[model samples]
Target: MRLGLVLSEAGSGLRRNFSMVVSIVLVTFVSLTFVGVAALMQLQIGQMKGFWYDKAQVAVYLCNDAVQNSNCPSAATTDEIAAVKTALSSAPVKTFVKSFRFEDHQLAYTNFKKQFKGNPVADYVTPDILNEAFWVNLNDPNQSAVISEAISGMPGVDAVTDQRRLLDQIFAVLNTASITAATIAALMLVAAALLISTTIRLSAFSRRREIGIMRLVGASNRFIQTPFILEGVLASLIGSVLAAAATIGIVQFFIQGYLQTAQRDINFVTISEAIVVVPILIGAGVVLAAVSANVAISRYLRV
Candidate 1:
């Protein structure tokens, strides 16, 4: 009987402040949508980093000269190449250094020409002018900086380059976008919380006479409070469900079909993963609304 009465009161309160309830729901829905997108984007960033970084390589170019004590050489002798390989294979860096090899000018030029065969630039350039290079693969690319620094000053080494810088720039852009979405979401969430508080306060004031009468009739604080809290929670839950539905539709239509087809090489997260985030967002909204309503009602019901 107590629970029934509390629920009836909550429903009546929501019905009385329909406009305010709608506003709260819409605000939460919009806010949580952005929050969900940011979360998914962050997850994508992690996935991309995992996929690409593991395949990243550190290229150590060798000098082409024999007598050139300078890192740059006209040609590298057999002994010099052997010494370079031996040093790379024998230390702390050696554990993760999976393979290392010297590529002569001819072989490097062949690869260079092969890659640009269809390009207009290919007509203006030929393989003969390209420099010889050394390709090195590491077991863990994260340890590449250590290897790069170690071999940079070594004899017969021309230059050391790692692919990680490119990956960093790519991931940085995605992270920025994700952060921006999260910021927008947070702002909207604050606005929604304030709106909910205001709405609940208004509802409590309108019901002031009824509440006073109920208290006079021996109604407990819990009885009076439970209904308001439930009203706020219901509003938030509706918003969460709306946001989740919107996210599902957007992912299914915009992301899975349109964006994926347009950017064939880029992989986006599956719709199923996106749907999973909805519950979490909804839970957050419910908690925010409940707390805000509780705080707003406390001052009004102090009598």
Candidate 2:
């Protein structure tokens, strides 16, 4: 009986301030949607990083006739190559290198031909011009720097390139995008909270006479505030549902339907991942609205 009466009062308040209720709903919807997108973007970035980092290798390229650095005035001799191999097999550097394979000029040339097959550039390239390289796989990708520092500027080495460097640049762009979405979501959430507070204040203002009557009848503050808080919770709940639906649609259509097919190499966030975000959005919306409403109503009742 008590619950029914409180719900009835809440419904009446919602009806009295229909426009404000709608504003809260819309604001909550957009804010939660951004929250969901930012979460999924972060998940996607993590997945990409894990997938790429595992495959990344450090390529230590040796000097050849076509390339001349101050450290390598001429092509690397057989003894210079032997010394590089010994250095890789020796202390400090060897600890980081899980395994190393030397790719000779012939193998490099073959790989280049296969990569640029049927291209005019392939016709002009020769095996002798290609640099020999030690492709080093690391037990931990983060240790690539250790290997590079040890091998770079050596007698026969031209450059020590860690594939992770390129991957870092790509992930940096993705991190920036995720942060932008999160910032927008935070601003929208603040707007939603303010809207909820305003709506509750308006509802309380319209029912000041009723509130005075309840007060005179010895009704508790809890009883007076319950209906108003329920009004905010219900409105925000509706918005959260819409945001969840929108989040699901994005994972289904945009990520799975388009991005997966378009970029087959990349792994995207799935529906299951977005489903995890739905409850979080709903909980956040409900809590924010409830708190905002409670504070707003408490201030109004005190006056």
Candidate 3:
């Protein structure tokens, strides 16, 4: 019976303050959408790090007769190549380099042809012009500097290039974007809280006479407060649902559909991954509205 009464009052309150409720809903929707995007951005960054970090290699470029570089005073001889192999096997550098493979001109040429197949640039390249190099795979891509430092001054080596450095710059940009979205989301949430607080206060003020009569009739404080709290909670919940739906659509239609296809080499976040954020949005909405409603109602509930 009391549940039904509370539900009745809550519904009436919503109808009376419908416009403010709508405002709360829109603000919550936009705020939680930012939260969801922030989550998705974090997931994407992690996935990219996992995928690229595993594949990143530190190339130890060796000298070639066709190329003249300071690191290679003369063309790399068979003995110099042997010396490099021996140095790679030494204890100090072995732990830094997870595994290293030497690619001769023939294999390098084959890879080049496969990479630039049917391109006009491929016609000018010959097997002898390609540098023979040791490709080093590291256990941690962040430790590329260790391997590079150890191998850079070695005989017959031209340069040590870590591909992961370029990836780091890209990820730095993504991190900045995620942080910016979260900051904006926080500001919007503050606005939603204030709006909800004002709405609840107005509803309590307009219904003061009814509340006073109930109090005189021996209504409990919980009973008097339940309806007002529910009003705020319901609005926030509806906003959360809308936000979840919109966030998923953005992830599927725009991110996965367009961006993923355009950058097929990257592994994009799936709909399931984006959906994981829904519960968080719902929880944030419920908590925000409930707290705001109670805070706003305290001063107005005279009894």
Candidate 4:
């Protein structure tokens, strides 16, 4: 009987302030949408870090015939190549270096051209003119500096380049983006909370006389307060649910459909992953509403 009365009062309150309920729903929707986007952005950053970090490699370029040096002999000598290979295979760094090898200029140019098929640079670059480079796969990409330091002055080696540093810079940018999104979401959520509180206060204000009469009769504090609190909670929760649905729809229709098409390699988390955030959002909204309603009723209850 208590539950039914509370529910009926909640329904009556929402029905009377229907416009305010709509506004609350819109605000909650907007806030939770940002929260969902922020969650997906963080997920993407993690995915990118894993994908790029695992595939990172160090490229070691060798001297060519045009370069005049005894170690290179204007070109990589048989003994020079052999010595470099032997050093790589049996050096102190061997355990860390998964494998290292030489690639002819022609093969290097072929792969490079394939990547830039119609570009102007592709027109000028050919395998015969390019310098040969040795590609090194490491057991750990983060140890690029150590690997480079070991091979820098070795015979037949002209330069040691580690691509991992470039990836680190990119990862830093992703981290910054994630932080910025989180900050924005935090501010918006606060704004939503305030709006919800104000809306609930106004709704409570309209029923003040009815509440006074209830107290004048024989109503207990809990009996009067429970219904109002439940109304606020219901409004907030319904708003959050609407927001979650809209967020999922927008992501599925726009991000996965368009942005992903343009950048095929990037796989953003799906709506299912983003949906995990809904329960928290709804809970927060409900709690905020209930607390706000309780505070507004406290003054009337005391008087």
Which candidate wins on lDDT?
2
**Candidate 2 clashing pairs, residues 3+ apart or interchain:** none
Please give each candidate's TM-score: 0.80, 0.87, 0.84, 0.84
TM-score of 2: 0.87
State in Å the error of residue 117, model 3. 9.3
- Assess each prediction's global lDDT (C-alpha) against the native: 0.82, 0.93, 0.90, 0.76
Q: How many clashing pairs does model 2 include? A: 0
lDDT of 2 by residue, 218-253 (tens): 999999999999999999999999999999999999
lDDT of 4 by residue, 68-125 (tens): 5665566666787777677678758788888777788878888888779889988976
Ranking of candidates on lDDT, top first: 2, 3, 1, 4
Model 1 per-residue lDDT tens digits across residues 120-198: 8767754445556667788877788877777887766777899899889988898999999999999999998899899
Model 3: worst 10 consecutive residues (lDDT sum)? 294-303
TM-score head-to-head 2 vs 4, winner: 2
Instruction: Please give the distance, in angstroms, between residue 39's alpha carbon in candidate 1 and its true position after superposition.
Output: 1.1
Model 3 ranges off by over 4 Å: 63-79, 90-96, 103-132, 140-146
Of the candidates numbered 2 and 3, which has the greater TM-score value? 2
Cα lDDT for residue 85, candidate 2: 93
